[model samples]
Target: MSNTTVKRGEGILSRNRGVLVAFGIIGTWAISLIVLLLIDISQLAIGWRIAATIWQTFLYTGLFITAHDAMHGAIAPSNPKLNQRIGSFALLVYALFDYKKMMRTHWLHHQQPASEVDPDFHNGKFKNFFAWYGYFMFRYWSWVRLFGLMAIYNIISLVLKVPEVNLNWFWVAPAIASSLQLFFFGTYLPHREPEGGYVNENRAQSSNWSVFWSFVTCYHFGYHEEHHEQPNVPWWRLPELHQRKLNAD
Candidate 1:
């Protein structure tokens, strides 16, 4: 909480930096999706389309990661309303998510991670990857989200004259893939119980991956323990803190 009140410092993300990065991600995601929809995928080679899909998925992941930073007050620490607004926009663009609802659920996750009360927890029964992912989606899924997506898809394909193939490949597929990417790197791998049992109060673990792979995986979210320890650190700074702690050890 102390970190949340501070401005620029060692390992502390400044408000301007957070805002710039947050808007940068949102801007890129919006522009990329729009361009992809407008492009003639039929004219493009299969390899290019595949590359575009992967790139779009990474952007989708960035959208959520940006929103996650806002949840911790890292985006605009002194301006609560601005923080919420940015987070809300990102979540809406991501999946028609309710920002306030997600904020509450995420705080619960931080407070009681891997416990029965934690919304993100799988209660030990869903140890299998697909099973836990199913549980996780079920927990967050709403009829509104389903119908909202349907409505959006219809509007984009019909009124906007975007091709169904473009919507399927560039728009929908990337979002689904991004969810798996986020869950694997940020939640499942970090929070799943180990054979020796939990090691700390955070009830989380971190990857030993280098910084590049950490960012490639999930914006450094694989450093889960560092996150729980300093919840105010933005996604981009986790690697610095992680490396510092690793050096200390």
Candidate 2:
């Protein structure tokens, strides 16, 4: 296939079907949490409190999908409105604050997977004896800084009572912490491509399990190579395109 050849046919709804399902599941879970919160308010049950915490974690995972769609410009049905609404909503939930800026940065990530400029790259490795141990333990400090900024944003928003910013202190702290953890363990850590590493003919197999889960939770982001190869294709059809390339290869 020619580099410039565009693969079409992934419609808005088709691409977003997984996201729509995720929304339904999250909505159900949220409603259950609200009921639990109401019960806790009336009679203060420890079990209810525990359940609420678990549900909150699930909600954060759901927000990942929200961020993914917004980044891909797939949420609002059109480009201009899509970015504004989805970006704003994600910022409100994840305390990201600047979706446009994040999107620009994310584009660079896609452009350079394991290169020095890629903020997500895991650079250090151990020799002979402790190679595996060192590889697993080595973490990227840049990602920590990125998430630290997000946490700071959330704290300031809560302190200031910003409109559209949810002021629930109960979840705010944990949300920030979880978002940071997800950014490291869940996203960047698994996506590092080594120098001269084999690029999988099948894009789906190229990424690690964390990225695969990310694709499920965050639209089709795990199909990283395909997305880089063809940014015009919608998120929903990413897997299909990857499969086609694999078959052709």
| TM-scores for every predicted model | 0.94, 0.54
Which window of 10 residues has the lowest lDDT sum in candidate 2?
161-170
Local accuracy of candidate 1 as per-residue lDDT tens digits, 68-164: 9999999888888998899999999999999999999999999999999999888578687889899999999999899999999999899989999
* Model 1, global lDDT: 0.93
Q: Model 2, range 33-146, lDDT digits (tens) per residue?
A: 344333424354657545555556556655655565567665544455645565566555554445666677666666665555654444445222234223423432246646
**Alpha-carbon runs more than 4 Å astray in model 2:** 1-37, 41-55, 123-181, 184-186, 194-220, 232-236
After superposition, candidate 1 runs with Cα above 4 Å error: 1-14
Give the least accurate 10-residue stretch of model 1, judged by summed lDDT.
6-15
Query: Which candidate number would show the highest TM-score if scored against the true structure?
Result: 1
